[model samples]
Target: MVGTALGLSLVLLFLSVPVFLVFGLGSGLVAIFGLNLPWSTLIQVSFGAVTKHVLLAIPLFIFAGLIMLRAGVARRLVALAMAMVGHWPGGLGVAMVLTMGFFAAFCGSILAAITAVGSIMLPEMKKSGYPPAFSVVLAASAGLLEALIPPSNAAIIFSSLTNVPVSQTFSAGILPGLVLMVLLIVVVMIRGRAFSRNERAGWGARLVAVRRAVPSLLTPVIILGGIYAGLLTPSESAAVAVVWAAFVGFFIHRELTFEGVWSALKATAVTTTVIFSIIAMATFLAVVLTYTQAPQHLTAYLLQYGIGPITFLIMVGVICLVLGTFIEIVPVFYLTVPIFMGIALTMDVSMLHLYVVFTAFAGIGLLTPPVCVGIYTAASVANISADKAFPQVPLFVGVGVIYGVLMIFTPWLAEWLPSALH
Candidate 1:
């Protein structure tokens, strides 16, 4: 029965069915036919799943992210990053990493960062003699930080599902994001030695860049800072960020137009709908799994096989990586969480730790092949074939996997900040 239901889900996914249907129909059928649940069970669980307050943060963050991207927030921040690092050997390489990290601080989506920031950086990277594959790979991989940083919708969703505080979930990602940043910096520095370095910007230019960026730079601080300080909830912080982003767009930067806000709203609506549906359906499936005692059985199976926390986490990485190739990032996240969370409890694994690692692996999914949306987006922005970019991905993805294992060994890398903040 388990195998059949899993097969149904995979088949529906392969047919390009909507994820809501994949979760709803595939899991629903399993519940009804295999588990003897009534059809009404689906409606009850799906509707309940979407009602959480933390879910409110998602659409708000998405809207603010879109507005900031169009308002040239990435442009100003990229300038500041280049000014800070452009004189160093392989500075553009380092600059790209910094730009992605800085962009991540404002924008919360990896695909958006890849598209918006990559367009700005990839061409310069090519002009500066960086390899095309290297350029796309860097943009796609560093783009992961967008989802890892504060104001991350991914973190917001995880917090909602797991009952963790949103601020703590956001804080948990800080060190791992920084550690990955340093690793990329080192790799780029060595390989970047072969690429041409830009002439250092004059102090006057640096000052101007900093002056222009200061308003945009305050964005992450205002959004995440308020949350950490306990002055605002995640939803409230998102609301404030949206207003601040629009203010910067309309008055400060003057690049954002009325049409941009409208488009951002429409896009946010569509994205929010899709994400909410996935969450709803995933919740339905989790209830179904519980009814069938699947979690207990799976836990017993793992223990019977002598699996421990380390092995279980490694298995999870493998599972997420494989599913990510076929499923979009959000659906992959919700689809796996129910199953993983259950078994993780039995292993004495930290649920918070499992979630942070899960989110990190989702980033790698964007870099993984066949469905590497992150790479394709970066490649398109770079005007290179994704096939050309594929060869370069393994190294970055390997580093990411290493970071996942590192997080496993050093759970404190994710847990410490969240705990301290509490």
Candidate 2:
């Protein structure tokens, strides 16, 4: 019965059903018919799933991201980046990577990171004679740091699916995000030979840039600082983030207006609705998986078939990589994350290690060839053909793989900050 339901899901997914229905139609029905589970229980579970307090953080963060997007927050961060790196050879590249990492901390989604940061930096990178392909690819790939950075929507969703604390997941993602940022900057410098450097900003200019960016920079400090310091639950931190973002956007930046906030609220509604739908369906599917003992049986079957933890981890990476390329990263997550819990439990892996590391791996799919979402997003932002960014995919994906290998050896990288605070 479990195998049949799983197979049905694969077929329906290929046929382009929405993920929620894929879960409901395939797994939910199997539990109903095969196991005689009641639809009432499934309905109750789905309703309860969307009620998580931590989930509140998502919509608030989304609203904050939308406000930041409209307020031109990226420009200030880019100014700071330029002041810091603008004089160095290949400084534009350094600035771009740094801005993406920083903005991701303030902005919630990769879409905003790439759109806001890419809109500003791509023009500069081009004017500096950075290879067009390199510029677009860099924006698309490095922009993924938003997912690995704190205040990450990806981490929140992963936590929701796995019942992991949102704060730990957010904290766990930091080292990987920072490592990837450093690696990307190095790659940019190596490729920076042809790109021209900007005139160095003097101390006065640097001070002005820093002064203008101080308010923007403080958003992440407030959000993550409160979470790490245990002064705020993830939800409370998110609410505080919303209030702070509005304050900065309207009063300090003077770019965000009432119209912008209304628009952001509308956007938040749409995005949250879609996200909660997926979470609700995933909750139901999880119940179905539990009812059928699929996760348990699969773990036993894998062990019986001689798969060790090392092999299991590799398989998880490959699955995320492949699915991430073809599917949006979130849906790839919905399909796999719940099933992995049972397998993750049998190993010595912490949920933080598994989720953070795999989130990075899933990000690679967006950066990989063929159906690369990163390339497409970059292409759209650069107003260039997708093929232009294709060649740069391998180099960025290679960096992600290297990060994965690092995580495999140094679980502490993902776990330490969370532990230190715990």
Q: Which candidate has the top score in lDDT?
A: 1
Q: Provide the TM-score for each candidate, comma-separated.
A: 0.96, 0.95
Residue lDDT tens for model 1, 51-133? 88888888888889899998988889889999989978779878889888887776766787788788888899899899999
Best-performing candidate as measured by TM-score: 1
Please give the distance, in angstroms, between residue 205's alpha carbon in candidate 2 and its true position after superposition: 1.0
Span of 10 residues, lowest total lDDT, candidate 2 = 366-375
Clashing pairs in model 1, backbone N/Cα/C closer than 3 A = none
Runs of candidate 1 exceeding 4 Å displacement:
none
lDDT of 1: 0.84
Return the lDDT, model 2, position 125: 84
Off by over 4 Å in 2: 369-371
